[model samples]
Target: MKRVLALPYLLWMVVFVILPVFLMIYYSFNDMSGNLTLQNYAEFLSSNYIKMTLNSFWYAFLITVITLIVSYPLALVISRLKHKTFWLLIIIIPTWINILLKTYAFIGILGINGILNSVLEKFGLMKIQLLFSDFAFITVAVYIFIPFMVLPIFNSINGINKNLIWASYDLGASKWEALTKVIIPLSLEGVKSGIQITFIPALSLFMLSRLVAGNKVVTLGTAIEQQFLTNENWGMGSTVGVFLILFMVFVMLVTRTKKESI
Candidate 1:
């Protein structure tokens, strides 16, 4: 009966997930003539593509790190608040809006003659260039992805046994010590889940890269999109897509292994 209930989900995965992956694998290894060859892989493995992969990883890493740093503390504070649901809603509200809308909103705020610079000028301060830069890219990524980080950590913290925390304090442990030694260790699963969600999407965020950084930030996602849409090189696009899939699988495997080892 349980398996019967899950059949629809299984079918959905087969159609959406497994089928797309198989198609990507097929296309990645085939040429325009539909001849199977390694030429796509060879070209994609070149230095330029490798650099884009690394840059994507670096930017994603920065975004993940910043999100974690910001989220854990914010979650900690929010978890202690009486109006936790309200606060969480506030954090999540922006996510309900369209991504493109949010991106354009940032554009208005960060543009040269945008709200921020206008306010600075009114204060007799020199206007700062905020758009089309690495700073702008990362700031927007963090803004968009922070909720993914916060929610998981918040759930982990919320699920913790209050008695254990009380016990730690009763044993003469400082708040920081209790947090580091007890609370955080037990919350590793949530942190891992959050990182997976935040990092994976950030890794493939071509739209944000283009809108926020003005194409100055070249990522694997943007590269794939360009190959597929702009250059009409489906083979190369699938090759990059294959690389991204493998990279994500590698990350998940590595993180899971680390968790098992610990």
Candidate 2:
């Protein structure tokens, strides 16, 4: 009976997720120049591809680390609140806005002639270049993706049996020890899920980086988009897309293996 209602969701997922992914894989293996060729993969193996992939990973890693640093404390603060729904709404409200709109709003706040730089100049401090750099890219990425890190960790930590925490305190164990040994260990799934979310969206952070930070700092996403739009090199673009997909799968597999080992 439950399957009757679940069938639509299953069908929806099959149509949207499964089909598109299969099609993308098919597209990746296809090469133009009048026939399908292995040239796409070989071209992607060039130095530029290697460098772009590394750069993308480096930026994504920084964004993930920064998001973790910011979100964990916010999640903790949130956990103590009286109205869980209210606090959740407060955290999630901004996410409802358009991503492009949020990026532009950050630009208005951080750009050289924007509010922050203007305020700094008024105070007679150094007029630093705030926008169109790695810092800007990362800061925006962190702001955008922090919620991904938060929700999973929040759910993870929240699901922990409160009695255990109380029990540890009653047993004369310090709160720090209790959290480190008991809470965090049990919450590992949440942390790992948060990391997966962090890495995945951040891995595809082309639009925000290109929009908020200008076209200066490039990632594999930008490289792929360029191949599709600017260069109109669909074969090469699809090859880069293939590489990005493979990287995501590899990361997910590694994460799954690590979790299973534990």
Candidate 3:
């Protein structure tokens, strides 16, 4: 009966998720002539693709680290706040706005004669170019991903046993020591989850790189987009897609917590 109730979901997964992956794998292994070949994979192993992959990883790592640094303190404060729900809602509300809208909003804010530059000019300072740079890309990415990083860490910190903290104090541990030893260790699962959430998507931020960085930044996702849309190289696009799927799986495995047996 339970399986019967899950049929719709199972069918949806088969049709949308499983079928698409299988099709991508099929396309990835076949050339334009539809002949099976390893040329797509070979091309991805070339210097250009390798460099792009490393660039993507580097950016993803930066985004994750920055997001973690900002989010951990914010999440810790929110967890201790009297109005936790309200603060969390504020954090999440931006996510409800369409991503395109958010990106465009940043474009306006980061553009020449935009709010930031206008403020700088008012302060008798030279206007710095913020748009189409690595700084703008990373800032926007961090802004977009902050809520995702915060939520899990907030949950983990909030769920912590207060007794343990008090016990640490009773044992003569300083505030910093208590936080470092007791709270941080327990909250690691949330940090791991946050990294998993932020890093993977950061690796494949195609539209953000295009719009925000103005093609100056070309991550793995941009490469995939180019292969499919601009170059019409579906075989290579599928190869990249296959690699991305593997990367996602690898991240999930690394972040997943193993259950201890009793």
Candidate 4:
């Protein structure tokens, strides 16, 4: 009966997820001529493409680290609060806004002639170029994705057995020791999950990079868009997509291995 109920979900995965992945794999290995070839992946070996891929990793790493640093402490504080649900709702509210709208809103705030500089000018400060920079792009990405980082860590911390912390105290361990040795280790799963959500999406952020960074930062997502949309190179686009999927899988496996070891 339970398996019967899961048939719809199984069919959905086959039709949507599994089939698309297989198509991507097939296309990645072939060229426009429909001949079996590795030229699509080989093209990424060029210095320009390689550098773009690395830049993608670098920005994604920075975003993930920043999000994790900000989120964990915020999650800790929120988990201790009586109105946790209310605060979580507040954190999630911005996400309800369309991402494109949010990006444009940031433009209105961060553009040279936007609200921020207008206020700065009134205060006798020179207007700085805020838009079309890497900083602006990262700032928007972090803001947009921080909720993903927060929720998982919050759930992990909130679910911890309170008695364990009490037990550590009862055993003469200090608060810092209990946190470092007990809480953090136990919350590894959530941390890993948050990283997966935040980092992976950050790597493939095309629209925000274009709107905010204005080509100052080139990511794999941007590369994929260029190949598929602008250049109409489906094979190259699928190749990048396949690499991204493999890289994500590698990260997940490594995280799981560490979790099991601990």
TM-score of 4: 0.94
Clash numbers, per candidate: 0, 0, 0, 0
TM-score of each: 0.95, 0.90, 0.97, 0.94
Candidate topping TM-score: 3
Query: What's the residue-level lDDT of 29 in candidate 3?
Result: 94
lDDT by residue (tens digit), candidate 4, 1-262? 9999999999999999999999999998878767889888789788887898899999999999999999999998999999999999999899899999999999999998999999999999999999999889989999998899999999999999999999999999998999999999888889989999988888889999999999888999999999888988889899999989988987778667363767
Which residue pairs collide, candidate 2? Answer: none
The best-first sequence of candidates by lDDT reads 3, 4, 1, 2
Worst 10 residues of 4 by lDDT: 253-262
lDDT string, candidate 2, 126-217, tens digits: 88888888888899888888777889888888888899999999999897898788887877787778888889778778898788778777
Give the alpha-carbon lDDT of every model.
0.90, 0.81, 0.94, 0.91
Candidate 3 residue-wise lDDT, 1-262, digit = tens = 9999999999999999999999999999988777899999999999999999999999999999999999999999999999999999999999999988999999999999899999999999999999999999999999999999999999999999999999999999999999999999999989989999999999999999999999899899999998889988889999999999999988888788766212
Report the candidate with higher lDDT, 1 versus 2.
Answer: 1
Worst 10 contiguous positions by lDDT, candidate 2? 26-35
Pick the winner on TM-score between candidates 1 and 4: 1
lDDT of residue 184 for candidate 4? 93
Q: What is the TM-score ranking, best to worst?
A: 3, 1, 4, 2
